[model samples]
Target chain A: MATSIRGRGGIGPALPLLTPAYLWLVVAIFLPLSAMALFSFMTELPMSGRDWSLTLEHYAAFFSSGLYVTLLWASIRLGLEVTLWCAIIGFPAAYVLARVLKGRAREAIFLLVILPFWSNGLVRIFSWAMVLREGGLLDTTLNAILPFRIDIDLMYSYPAVIIGLVHSYVPYMVLTCYLTLQAIDNALIEAARSLGASRLQTLRRVVLPLAMPGLLAGSVLIFVPVVGSFMEPRILGGRTGTFYGTVIEDQFVAVFNWPLGAALSFILLAVVLVILSLSAPILRRVQ
Target chain B: MTNLLGKLAAQAVLLSVCTVSVHAAELHVLNWKGYGADEPWAVEAFEKATGHKVVNDFFNSEQEMLTKLRTNPGLYDVVMINAAFTGQALAESLIQPIDTAKIPNYADISGEKANSPMLNQDGKVYGVPWVWGLTAIAVNDKSFETSPTSISVMWDEAHKGRVVIRDDAVEAIQFGAIASGQNINDIKDMDAVKEKLTSLMPQIRTFWSSENDWNQMVASNQIDIGTYWSGSADRAKTQFNLPVSLVIPEEGAVAWLDAFSIPVGSDNVEGAEAFINYMIDPEFYVEWVTKVGAPVSANEKAVAALPEDAFNRAVMGDPKVADRIQFQAPITDEQRKEYLAIWQELKVGAQ
Candidate 1:
């Protein structure tokens, strides 16, 4: 351990490199987390909103809790759905960009894809609201064609949330896949063609595999945050259904149960870790 | 499985850092959105009275404010909570009881608004009475073609798909109980409420959860009538040229009082109290009343000083709607559970 600490260079040379990160982790992440964990093992005094006894009641409550589990499952399901849809839709657009667009034109197209991503998340969601509401853009289009009135409701439903998530994440997936696809040597494809390999076969055998790393990274970036999200579900998800975000929010807000909220949050973190660990082997094979 | 992560760049660890700060010259307050703007006259007066930086943050709901408190125990020194939530927050010892002696300004507030049976419990005050409003029948006169005076109008089949009620299950259930001619206040028997409201749920156009949602629905003329606060109703009428009118149904309405209090974990207790004291001054109270036009229980001098139109808008309508508004009292735990259970059923049953 001492050797490991002293390591690749003299201690004096390495100390500056370690100091800032250590200070940051301690002040910003670890300290709050430690307080949260400590509180989870304690009992809050009723009406005080302050902890009283150092017990495991919160953990006990969480382990046997049906609400938390169901909400967790719902959140995971939504995350996976978002990830699958982003890839399916993003793949075709990314292919056209990577294989077709070149040089300055490609750069312009890339900026166009990221432009909407720069807008505030809330602004983008509400802009969709104007299109999806009862008398909104889609409604206006549908009304102009029909002979009579047909009221079709789409707002405040799961499909609305799905659309919002897909819209938000498609850009991210495209950028990742585009970068990976751009790095492929044109000579490799020219050689494959000369060696009697078909276009489709070359894509399947070479290009797709090369781009897998980008796909994996983008999926992680989108999935992890979306799984624990509250705003998207609250704004776009139908009223009849909710996710883990709502449950965690309620524990803290309605019930004043911070310890439970912290415990539930960590539980979500563990589940995300499990998912990533399980997928690592597949990611490696693609690489 | 391999698609789990899409490669882009270095992993970004988002650190949403929060720190507790204390300042003698500045005071931070958490209040309802749009309630903090000062009256032109009051602004000039308050600056002269106290040399402190007064700032405010708006929360969407009482629940949102409480969530901020839970995340960082001492993040906010003062928060606005309704009576029902305040009792629980006080009981949890999450909030500090108000010592009126420290706030001489509080003494100037009228006994009716300050020491009302609704604002006072067990002789220990935990909040300063701020504003009062009620959830009543907000009707689109264009739909009814007649003035509305009862909650039963929301149940009419003719208005199906046009009726809008608060998305709050508890409030909706209480309306169901009242419309069905049962006790609206003590919701001990939820079965009766569910039996009555389950049939009415389909009639609802949308269970609006926020002012924005309800406003948009009303603006588009999708929903014609519903229960809403006077402030929201007035905004819809004025801004969108909506034909909506707030009515105190013959069955009466549930009155609400939102008050400000210091959290028990407050780092700057003295600053918070001084801020709270500043809010009740006749100058600030009059300004708040003029801007918000919500019913306020304040010193007789403050109430007397407010524009008559503003005071009238808060209490009875210009023509006097009703005098029988009932406050939602802090019920027993059994009552709370009953409300929650009935609420769950209503939530599931609402389309």
Candidate 2:
């Protein structure tokens, strides 16, 4: 590890090479984050020409108001639901691609799975509306074939939002899990089989543990954006779509309350950090 | 080869210089989708008539437009704002008074429409009146045996699970206020409005944000009844062959007027004024209303020029219908906060 840190030379020689990337991060990430933090403490946007003072009223409002808390909880639950669904659906598909499938068919199928990522995300979510609404393509198609007629009015519901989010984000899980699963040696699995270990036992005890990093990476990737997503929920979930992200969006776009939005965003960031810290121990152990 | 390359470079320099000068003269407008100015050939005509090119941006809500105008001053030369927002715009000085002298077509605007309290505030014309419409009930005729003419039709049990409403806080609260026999402009009791909205919550299939989404839902038979703009309901009926029709309910509908204004810090005021003048022209107004299917214009000549049956079907044509409309008034900051809070609570309570 010491030699690894030392690299070809020492820290001094590497410093110059790393400067550009670190500088870019400072300019792009750190600056905006710092500005957002500062803005969170303001009473109003200074540019709005309102008589303003630095106040904690914005943060206090978050704690004082039950609505914000409820929405935040709803958003957290949505993230958890979407991330769980992505994992449940994605892991098996990745396993099949990495282990069972091979060559040209695997390549083509993998491309097909991730082809959704190439299209505009908003367009894809809107397309789901065409299929999910009452008397929509799904309803019409199912009614045409099914023995009994049933209404399939799913649009503007919670399930619609989840479906849209999962569709948009499942590709991330599959791609990550596939990379890690493919790296696992075939000999290890064969050895486990030779030792009379069941496939389920090997999967639970061996494959899962090794693939934990990819799973965690995918979870984090999916959860963070999902928590902050408002557009998908708005387009799909309708009135039932109101979440912490949408509230923040309303503050900025609808209410013109940038300071309050910044405050809410900061609080969300805090919650996310806490979640990441809590999960870090298990993730490190698996690594 | 070197001589040829040098000549090409010289030509490139000349071309870029011309482009830069033309770009500098461009007028940037922030408007709503299909709000009179960007129909089919509006922008092209404007560009051809004036040497200045027109760049357009769009916003769905008045609040969104306000935010854009507030944050990025001078970015937009012309903006189409609602009557409800003109007061705040004036107070904030986000927009400036139009020079009626420069816009000769301002004479064509009917006295009654031009003198609306929204367009002229404190004796200053802050906005050029454009299009006006009513927020009314859109119901599929096939859904009801008899035409439902009341706003209470939304809360009717028969329409439950098949009704949609606009996802706007103020408008939603207004509906509740109107239903409960309270003044929508000045709410004496917030709890009453809350109770009214909450009671109707179960009947609503969803609250839609966009006119397009609401219209499509109604057109496709996904929703049977909803509250939507007059123009969109008309479009969905005529264009999409939907059985949907708009009716001004007995409880009255909210009236909104969109007008053109030059932003405070705009350098291209002349270009913006020219555009506004062009918009109110009788021929342009007729063409705009025809393409857009909106029933009202500030210009009297345009209304007269419309087909014979158009007025009979429009809210503005009937004085009784027009008088009943509750024109959206600008809310105070405290009131705005209250309205939004009430809306947020309504959402949470429903969940």
Candidate 3:
């Protein structure tokens, strides 16, 4: 009756607890992806929904088709710009949250930071369009008094999409970076200050290096989704230079080629994985 | 022998009468939002007309409607798709051959310049004609001191950055094509199209993607001149106190017709045909066309019913204006590909 396996060496309790997460991950994530991978390999009817023999032509078309290449590259470039801008803006904001404000004030400011993101992405983009368009708020009210135009042509350019994307995802960056910067000991900053370092030097020498983990974390979180976004570019960037996400959407909806859509999705998944792989070592170094 | 033959003939007549008395059927219908938004009314109409219960749903776009049809043959009885989808839909055999004889009201169909298949290649009458429209250039008369007659002013370089057009691929491309004096349909030389489009891209303040986008652009005066559809301008002029005009350009416009077609699906073929016939009725066609801010095409009676102002503004049977307007056409897959490719180069060059 005495199953006294509470002994440390038995190792039986840990396996079962860990097994469920692995099982859950496989069932929820990997299994559906496996089915999609199977479908993507099969040939699709030109416009007759889905039918025919299995083939690799869709994959070939994705790479060999020049349109796909331009779009994919444009999306990558847009994500990089958003990520870079988010880091620049978010890091300082995050550092301030960690270092300057406290208690209700900090929480209130944090809520304000994320409150705008709670509304729909589509609505926010439209409002931004209202500001950015000519004779718009930025132009009529702001640029009228300025030396130059607000560059109305830029509303549908890569820059507009980037600005919209950066605005949308900056909160994610701030929160992640704030969490990391918070984990850094205030004692270290005090020590740096005690050693006769200025506030700027304390930030650079003590706070910045310690906060790298959160910065990298924020970058991955923002960049991956940014790369996948179609609506931002389609609405703000005018659908002329479609991102990778829009291409996948078109294959399924507009073109009625589900297989090609699936293949493109998997390629994007591969790209995400490669990015993760490349970033992991640098992330580890940050840690 | 005469008595026996008389009894057999009487029995046959009785059998035919029995079969006609009790049959029940349902029809599947697809349309845009707010169109079949009044489904109960349509259901009542269907019951009154054909003694069949109508099951109707709304599809946002032609592609979704056709996708549903392709996946499930004999599942949907009827669909209302836009004009731009018809060419490819016809070529792909996604649309069925309709028995035009059943739709007695087909002869009354107007907007012949836009909706009628006689104007296009492979002109098999698949889609029964529905509403062809006047969702065209709307101007704020206050914004323009003089009455304007051209779509060119929407892209004038002097107006420079104040210009606007829709963010849609085909519509915006058409605006550029019109500006460049290029054929909207046959734009194979992409370099020329790109160069032309790139020129316009700078002039445009916004390439509006949705109905809301165009409305906001005009209402706020974010854009002074733009190519916009009518339903939106009608709302702004009537409701928002925004003084805007929906113009017919001197050069003409590319217009559309949303029509009813039975996609390759449907269990109730007979019922679908009856439903299409029901929509074409003068009473049903008139309310829908006017309510949805569209101009009616199917009924002579409906055009006659419109108030004097709406009629004079071309909702009435104006053959001359209809003849002159350039109708929207469905591009081939090859053409669609080419158009988008050039559009990309245009965006990059604009930057």
The candidate that achieves the highest DockQ relative to the unseen native structure: 2
Error of 1 at A151 (Å): 5.3
Q: After superposition, how far is residue B142 of candidate 2 from its true place, in Å?
A: 3.0
Q: Give the Cα lDDT of each candidate.
A: 0.70, 0.84, 0.70
Candidate 3 lDDT tens digits, B1-351:
999999999999998766654333766677776553244665686678777766667765566776776666776778887877866676667777777678877777664533466324554577776766654577656578885887667657667766776644566577666655666666555566556677677786556656666666667665677777655565466456676777777676666767777777566778777887788776775554455444544566556666657742453246666654666777665555445545544554454
Candidate 2 docking classification: acceptable
The candidates, ranked best first by TM-score, are: 2, 3, 1
The best candidate in terms of TM-score: 2
Candidate 1 chain A lowest-lDDT run of ten: A42-51
> What fraction of the true interface contacts does model 2 reproduce?
0.49
By DockQ, the better pick of 1 and 3 is: 3
Model 3, DockQ value?
Answer: 0.22
The candidates, ranked best first by DockQ, are: 2, 3, 1
Kindly list the per-residue Cα lDDT of model 1 for residues B1-351, writing each as its tens digit.
344443322222222111222145455567776564333454445445665455566676565776666665766777878876787666656677788888878877657668765456688788887656677878877776777777778778888767766645457767776666665676566677677777776776555677777777767767778888876675566545667787778887777777778887676677677767776667776655455444544455666666676533445533344356666666554454345445544544452
Q: Say which prediction, candidate 1 or candidate 3, comes out ahead on TM-score.
A: 3
